[model samples]
Target: MSVVNPGDTVPSAKVVVSDHVSFEQFVVSRSRALLRTAYLLTQDRHLAEDLVQTSLAKWWAARRRVTGDPEPYVRRIMVNEFASGWRRRWRGERPTAEPPDTHGPAIEPHTDLWAALANLPRRQRAVIVLRFFDDLTEADTAKTLGVSVGTVKSQTARALATLRIDPLLKAD
Candidate 1:
């Protein structure tokens, strides 16, 4: 049996009763932040876009369950999906090799910052992004990661320590 689309329902049907806000409005408001965070996690613009679309689809499908400040919720979903994809790759015990030359000038690259972020374990990177980029409080970040506040504190210290050697930030 075919599942019915929203418009297929009879007139006066309540597909979304909350504010009657269309999906387009929500996407327009949140796409940039979602895409940026996805890029940071996936490290590829195209992949980041796919990640955001996947996340948004999931979020919209479960729209009634979420209310107020959905950004963190969606970000968490994107991160989880990214980690899941990484696990599916066949990169076991790979050798250290030179990175691609996407770091050349004219990009205004935050090479040090990004390299430092990449060095972090997945959980730590997620925490750092939620705490710093998302400007979420420690308690909120912990909630998003489903970890204790103590874990956030420990992970943040470790990530910042790794970044401290960047030299760009040392003089600042």
Candidate 2:
């Protein structure tokens, strides 16, 4: 008879029906924002959507076991998926390329930074994305990147230098 508030922890329902409205509400409230983070990390709109949806699906599936914030879990999954794709590329197994026409619509603005950023080595691009775009701490960036903190620091420095030297690039 009463509407549930966002982020409210009410009595847990039957395992089958717990937090249905709240979960949907949460998704509706935050899904687009989350997708933006995914897009920044993956740089492919379609892949970003897949990453966000996949992250949400995994979260929904494991909703019960989740004790703390679900956002971080989904974010980690998306990051890991992006990292996995990067690892695959590093291993020389390319994912099947989708022709540009297959994607339904153009959603993001193209930028000079995008061009310069595309020129970065993979590790540096990742360091920039995780550290700056995600606003993650250096320690968290290192953890997400599966590298030493010193590596994250150096990669970020080089990445910033590359961007700085390229006059076409601008700060976000």
What lDDT does the true structure give each of the candidates? 0.69, 0.69
lDDT of 1: 0.69
Q: Please identify model 1 stretches exceeding 4 Å from their true place.
A: 1-17, 83-109, 166-172
The digit string of per-residue lDDT tens for model 2 on 28-77 reads 78888788887776678876776787777777888788765667767776
Could you estimate the TM-score for every candidate? 0.69, 0.65
**How far does residue 80 in candidate 1 sit from its true spot (Å)?**
3.4
Clash pairs for candidate 2 = none
Best by TM-score: 1
Tens-digit lDDT string for candidate 1 (58-110): 78788788887666667777777665444234345343542333233432246
Which pairs in model 1 have colliding backbones? none
Ten contiguous residues with the weakest lDDT in model 2: 98-107
